[model samples]
Target: MSKLIFVNLPVADLPRSIAFYEGVGATKNPQFSDDTAACMVVSETIHVMLLTHAKYRQFTAKAIADARTTSEVLICVSEDSRESVDARVSAAVSAGGTADPTPTQDFGFMYGRSYEDPDGHIWEVMWMDMAAANEAMACEGAGQAA
Candidate 1:
């Protein structure tokens, strides 16, 4: 079976979070959703579980960090091209997310941007040309050896 990833996030407002995720291209999986939690599907192998603060507390004993004010986790996903990366960040901004919580990254072979969800969880979107990245890294390695 292909490995799947389920990212669980604590959200202050369930419905708002659901709408925000849907705006960013995720679809809610009703089969796994309820009043307190939502299952948002990003891809066949990637799912995000949006839980209310109460629902989230059931799973963790640590205090929930205010993502807006404190750094917790940086979730990253890859896109097909540099344009797609920018498009996703724009969509996120349109959906009420704050864009570029972190600085944008652009190398010849790679590009990246980030957005912060309503709850301040940062999500980074990136695209890369593997061949170019490998070639650059190889050159850097050779220079180091020399």
Candidate 2:
């Protein structure tokens, strides 16, 4: 069976967080959702659990790091193309997120941009050219490229 991933994040407000994620094209999984938490389906295998701070603490003994004050994690998603990355970031900005000033582009191999949500959660939108990466790997294997 394929492995499943559930990323649980603490949110100050569950409803607001759900609305923000919905704006970014994510659908809520009502089957696993409730007043304390909402399951956001990012993809078939990826699910984000936006749990209220009070409820989220019940799952872990460690204190929840305030995302607004510290960098606890950076969520990154791969896009099909660079334009898609840009579009996603733009949508994020329009939905009350802040886009990073500069985007990282490493030739034709990889490109990425970042946005921070209202609560300071970072989301990176990236595009990776697997064909270019494979070609570069081949050249490096031949001892000609870095």
Candidate 3:
């Protein structure tokens, strides 16, 4: 069986976060959602668990870092095309997210953009040409292990 990843995030408002996630193209799985937590399905293999701050404390004693002040991590997802990458970030902004401090990248073969969710969690949307990337890497000796 393939391994699945469940990203657990602390949310200040469950319903608001749910709405934001849905706006950004995630599906809410009601079977795994409740008053204190929401299961946002990104893909078959990727699920994001949004837990209320109080409920999050049940899983960990450490205080949750204010993501706006301190970044714990950046969540990146890939899309089918460069246009899709921009569309996702644009949707995020319309859904109450802010653009990342970093600017969008356009390397011809790969394009990426980032946004910070309402809670200040970072998310990057990217698109890459795998075949072109592999060829470039080979030409640059990037894939060779000496």
Candidate 4:
């Protein structure tokens, strides 16, 4: 069986978080959700477990760092093309998430942008052209790529 990945994030409002996730294309999985927690399916293999601040306290004794005030994690997802990357970021912004201030990356073979959810968790959407990357590698000298 294929392995599944679950990213757990602490959210101030569970329902709001679920709505934000849904806006960005994730479907809520009621099977693994409850009043204090939500299971958001990002893809077939990726799921996000959104836990309320109080619910999160059960998993750790350390203080939860506010994602808005402090960097905790940058969750990245791959898209099929550059347009797809931009679309996701746009959807996120329209759903009340803030776009990352950093400029969008535009390498010849790769493109990426990021957005922060209402709870301040960053989500990066990236797309890589493998064929272009392979071609670039073929044309480049060893030192340049390194």
Task: Single out the weakest 10-residue window by summed lDDT for candidate 1.
Answer: 104-113
RMSD values, in order shown:
0.5, 2.2, 2.2, 1.8
Descending-lDDT candidate ranking: 1, 4, 3, 2
Error of 4 at 137 (Å): 3.2
Question: lDDT score of model 4?
Answer: 0.92
Q: Output the number of the TM-score-best candidate.
A: 1
Quote each prediction's TM-score: 0.99, 0.89, 0.93, 0.93
Candidate 4, poorest ten consecutive residues by summed lDDT: 136-145
Candidate 3, lDDT over the whole model: 0.90
Q: Please write out the lDDT profile of model 4 over residues 36-116, one tens digit for every residue.
A: 999999999999999999999999999999988898888889999998998999999888899864568999699999999
Top candidate, metric lDDT: 1
Tens-place lDDT digits, model 3, residues 1-146:
87999999999988999999998999999999999999999999999999999999999999898988998898899999988987888888899989755688888889899998889899988999999988888877964665
Candidate 3 segments whose C-alpha is farther than 4 A from its true place: 142-146
Please give, for residues 93-130, the per-residue lDDT of candidate 2 as tens digits: 88787888345655779889888777778888889889
By TM-score, the candidates rank as 1, 4, 3, 2
Between candidates 2 and 4, the lDDT winner: 4
What is the C-alpha lDDT profile of model 1 across 53-99, one tens digit per residue? 99999999999999999999999999999999999999999999999
* CA shift of 96, model 2, Å: 1.0
